[model samples]
Target: MYLKLLPFFPGRVCTIQDPLAAAVSFDGTVSTVSDTSCSYSAVQDGYSYNPDSYVYVDFDAHPTVSGFVDRTEHVFKDTGADPVTCPADDIQGCSFGPVTDKPKEINDVGTLALTTQLGSLTFNAILGVNQITTLYTDDTLLIFAPVSKFDELGGLCGEYNGDPADDLTIRDETVTTDAAAFVTDWKTDPNCVSTPARSMLRYHDQTSLCSGVPQETVSGFEGMCQDIISPHMNITDLAKDECLQILCICNDRDIGACEASLEEWFTTLGIVDQRKKDPLDLAIELQSAFL
Candidate 1:
């Protein structure tokens, strides 16, 4: 089972996308995403939320993409009435500027890596970024959709699933050279249950829940808020992770590395939430200010 979907793993994105998601995110029960964006929650079937399968949902439209590599796109194709016209050059800081490369392609371990050791170090790669994509929030796109919704879609995510409501015909791994036959086979199979962890991606804007309104969005470089940390710095985890990084390469032990990986090891290892004033009372203040 583990080896089967290895190719689809790179889609492992931070499940939760709360503006204040530097903290824990909740689907029904709150899930803890590591410092990086990757989330780990048990499936209804108790499968690991590793990247074996990724679900894509349109934040605005709630549709699947044409293919796994083609999760929903902010950019759409040109059609009759509404032709694909280029955006005015004056448009404000546009995210995902163009479809030069697939968003998942940049993942440290490529899609299959999510199931393996190399890309599992997802935390280190995602957190290190200081730039924000075109997303409205800092969290991964995965969390925006509820788990049930994620399950219904072929779990192809953006660039793939178009409408979860649409009948999904994509079936299992029966490779074919015939375009029509391959597409038919690909679309007819029951959406493969890759055991994705929708629970972990339960991120939502906490401004309304915590306070009522979203706080001024801040980033690490902006220095308005800081990522929260456990009162415990997780020293033991830190040591273990260092050891894993050094030794695992020689041993080919990915699971062991994950076990020993540092706290927030799966997600953000170093990046902290943007800075905030009165840092200690920030949580309470965030509630007071936003919620």
Candidate 2:
């Protein structure tokens, strides 16, 4: 955003015409005349008069043109109407001026990243189990949309068919013994049935969700989600079952009595509210915060 201060001529009682049309001359003089007056050399004690105009001294004109120049005049000239008089309070010392460049959009990664990782199969599985009721918050649901390829792949259901040997193939090659055991007995593991497992699964699901989301939305949520989930899973070497367990625990966590804990998590971190902030500003803020 750019701000231009009107030339402050304190104690000078001069009638203000179209300030936008006003231009500064090279010799530190301001002229409210047309462009024709720019080259005029006639000066009497630092003041000049047009062929058929009133006498006025010119003020020093800065070579660098203000962005407000011409714009203000254009509005008045085109409309052929008087400029709206701004109230003193409204025009207080400084006012917001025209924006020079486009603002950046803000995206929510929590919704996007989580949605991608939880592909249709794994996503549906969690929803099917309904063990971590809190994970189904409105914000979470907003983040969860049907992913086409994932839906096609049949997600977790296609990969895990109740057989330890077959399920073992679905696990990442670097999976640890404990992680392998968890996947081998996912059907009967008490921990797998609880919130920690749910959080872990949800976390993995969210990673996939991030990949599928729109770039803008993905940018918003990706970094923060990584920061929050980093301690639980080694993103570089993902272990499917282990990741799933972590997601379950996180998802099942209760953030006090608030149902909109997911949304609150963002707001609490000073993330911009999507509804209130400009999209570009939000994106920039998120990027800056994460960086």
Best by TM-score: 1
Range of the 10 consecutive residues with the lowest summed lDDT in candidate 2: 125-134
TM-score against truth, every candidate? 0.20, 0.16
| Total clashes in model 1, counting residue pairs 3 or more apart in sequence or in different chains | 48
* 87-189 per-residue lDDT for model 1 (tens digits): 2221222231232211322233321101111213211111102111111111222222222333332222211222212221223322222222322222212
| lDDT per residue (tens digit) for residues 123-223 in model 2 | 10011110110011111211111122121111111111222232112223322223223223222122322211111112123453234445664443444
Model 2 stretches astray by more than 4 angstroms: 1-165, 168-212, 231-291
- As a whole number from 0 to 100, the lDDT of residue 17 in candidate 2 is 18
Residue 257, model 2: lDDT of: 19
State the displacement of the C-alpha of residue 170, model 1, in Å, after optimal TM-score superposition.
6.3
lDDT of each: 0.21, 0.21
Q: Candidate 2: deviation at residue 46, Å?
A: 99
